[model samples]
Target: MVFKDKGRVMDGFYVTGHPSVPVYVLKSGVIFDGGFTALARHYERDIRDILGNTSPEYIFITHSHFDHVGSISYFKSVWPDIKVFGSVNAKKILSRNGAIELIQRLNNISRAHLLSYGVNDLYEGEFEPFLPDEVVEDGSVIRVKDGLEIHSRYTPGHTRDFMSYWIPEKRILIASEAAGCDDGSGYIISEFLVDYDEYINGIKRFMEMDVEVLCVGHRYVITGDDVRSYLLSSLQHAKDFVEMVINILNEENGDIDKTVNRVKAYEWDPRPFPKQPEMAYLLNTQARVKLIASKYMKN
Candidate 1:
């Protein structure tokens, strides 16, 4: 079952903001991702209502992408004591001025896109870049409470800093982009921005886990038998996407630019609204194509 509603989907899990860039919150006062600034502000009341009196104490960042961390500053302003956690590489990325600027720019573009879609309650502000308070390496376990523990897995590929959190007690895995995204189109989008091999390995690792609830990065919260089904399909999709890219690269005689354009025209241009921004899409596509061309086309 796919959940896209903006409320409590299960006992302790809540989804807020736009489904395209939804934020996940636990009743125990932990937020999975920051989401967009405007959307976060618009859904602030809903988030607070779900949290009740328990002020959010921690935010676990999946990666350092613009949309994934768009509302960190807003959350910090609301809960000044909230500590943010991410991988060590994420800390390095967020500290760079160029990265922050690009994030802000992409956020501005995203807000405008939202407005065009008739979303009028977006928060007005530039994206703020804040470093994580703690860096979690692979296999680090955070005790959320006496009985609840959030285990961090360093699953890179969507980004080198990507991390997936799993709660064994609840049988929930916050896979983020590590397990691909639904995008409301019933199609899983493989997001291997940095390394395709690592992305596939990350998916394989998730497949080995016993998951009941799977929280993707965007637009879908899968549950029950679908969890294993989704992970298996996601793994296949990631491999198929790479194969398609390699075929296109070969067709283009290993020309990265041409392959990127062809892939964009075939895969991205047909996607409807509530999708990734064109600039972001192009950048990620270029990275994927370049990686494939260099890694697979090396005679």
Candidate 2:
């Protein structure tokens, strides 16, 4: 069943949350970053039904993280002819046998957690290695259809391989983890797993763009005034976190655990997820503290 191409609408088609699948759909097909086939297991059919007869032409990965590229195998199985695009670093990471195995192993960890929550319609095909057809870098224009073009920009800092996309004419910017992950409501989690400077710089880079529609990496979109609101919050949060981590480290004499704990209590704008478990918050807090320490508090 093939879906007919429709005219470009202001908001073509966007979906998010529940199972946490975020994709930016265009007229040609749909564009997405990370995917968890296991999470989307129960909703894949509904997702397909929503898109009707439209087929994917490409799946542009934002980074090489296990969660980001987890469903490549499943997507490949569904759309064999779809081209995969990502940064050169992402290409190298996906090309490795070791990395592929590690991704599958991590995916299993995610799947087991999903089942605990009662989601079990997942396909058992993620333990396979899948490579991209196109290796793009900063400033690469990928033509999805006759007139639609997605310009790739290498926005490292989320991981060295992180890439974001910009559709010039539409004023839409698909910022990868370079910005921050929005937890549905309004809370944003600033996870700079690498360097704090890089993460902040990446956000600043996108801030220069005239974005009307902002697509975040996690599972949310910001439009109108919220687009600016999210970016401003992202910038301020990163700065605040870095400063707090540094001050805590200085006072605690570089005690990472103490710093992480302090950061854990820091209030996010609006608030963190209402149902966020302590363990999850602790883990992300630890990551934020560690990265901040490595980038700022180092001796």
Candidate 3:
């Protein structure tokens, strides 16, 4: 399921993918990817050439993670006149907080990212991180073209400000990392959980929608009425997760890490969960804890 052409349907609806990079272009010339890289030794020209080479009128970011946003600078350079859109929180993070610490941490472990791009992949030259030019919050509608409307819906279980896109006209929903990834197998791999219930609710929102196409961040996309049915099934899995975590916390007196692994065992595919067990636990624990914490905090 490699996305080779400029525009092609994965399940249904136009999309494109990069070999090491993740690039998706819509039928309306809306090009979207998460990041930009300047290292040509790796592949592709500087961020400048990648954006300049394409005719994408608009750019939408799924989240502000390093991989997802590596080519943002390229788009901004070529389409200085075009608008770059991302979650409002992502915009604020780029503008207000300098994520230097986070970048360094990611680089330390991102050997694969470097190897994929090829050669001295670490930021060596006068490299600068790509920042969003504009912000689009939850429920914001992106008019890709006439009759093609992509709606930005907030689903913060992955990251606090993460969002997924929906197109009502086509009944297609891009879940980003919200609904998690279903390998050809029976289990699901989650990106990270900032809020388990909200993530489940987000999945439910899309499942309830009149969607026929469901494109996620990675892996194969699912379509037809079966999309909603699968989503509902995923939601049940998540709910069972919440219940399992609750039971574990009660037994171990809030052992977050222990509870996280207990849940991870339920995953069908584990490669996407990352190697370091602690890192995996850290990513998944916060999501469940936050979901429970919010329940108590609500008035």
Q: Which is the leading candidate under TM-score? A: 1
Model 1 per-residue lDDT tens digits across residues 1-299: 87777777789888877667888888888888888776768557767888776678889999999989999889898889999999999999999999999999999999999999999878888887799999999999998854788899999988999999998988889999999887566667888888888898988898889888888888888888888888888888777888999898888888888988998887888888878999999998898888877788887
Q: Number of clashes in every candidate structure?
A: 1, 2, 13
Overall local distance difference test of candidate 3: 0.59
Q: Report the lDDT tens digits of candidate 2 across residue range 1-299.
A: 11112222255545432324444456456556646656544334544655676667778888887767776666677767778888888889888888887678777766766666676576665656777788888999987764778889877776778888898877878885788876654556776776677788888888888888776755556666777778888888777767777888999999999777666666532353332335545655777778777767659
Which stretches of candidate 1 lie above 4 Å from their native place?
none
lDDT of each: 0.86, 0.69, 0.59
Using lDDT as the yardstick, the better of models 1 and 3 is 1
Model 2 score (lDDT): 0.69
- Cα deviation in Å at residue 234, candidate 1? 1.1
Which is the winner by TM-score between candidate 2 and candidate 3?
A: 2
State the weakest 10-residue window (summed lDDT) of model 2: 1-10
Worst 10 residues of 3 by lDDT: 39-48
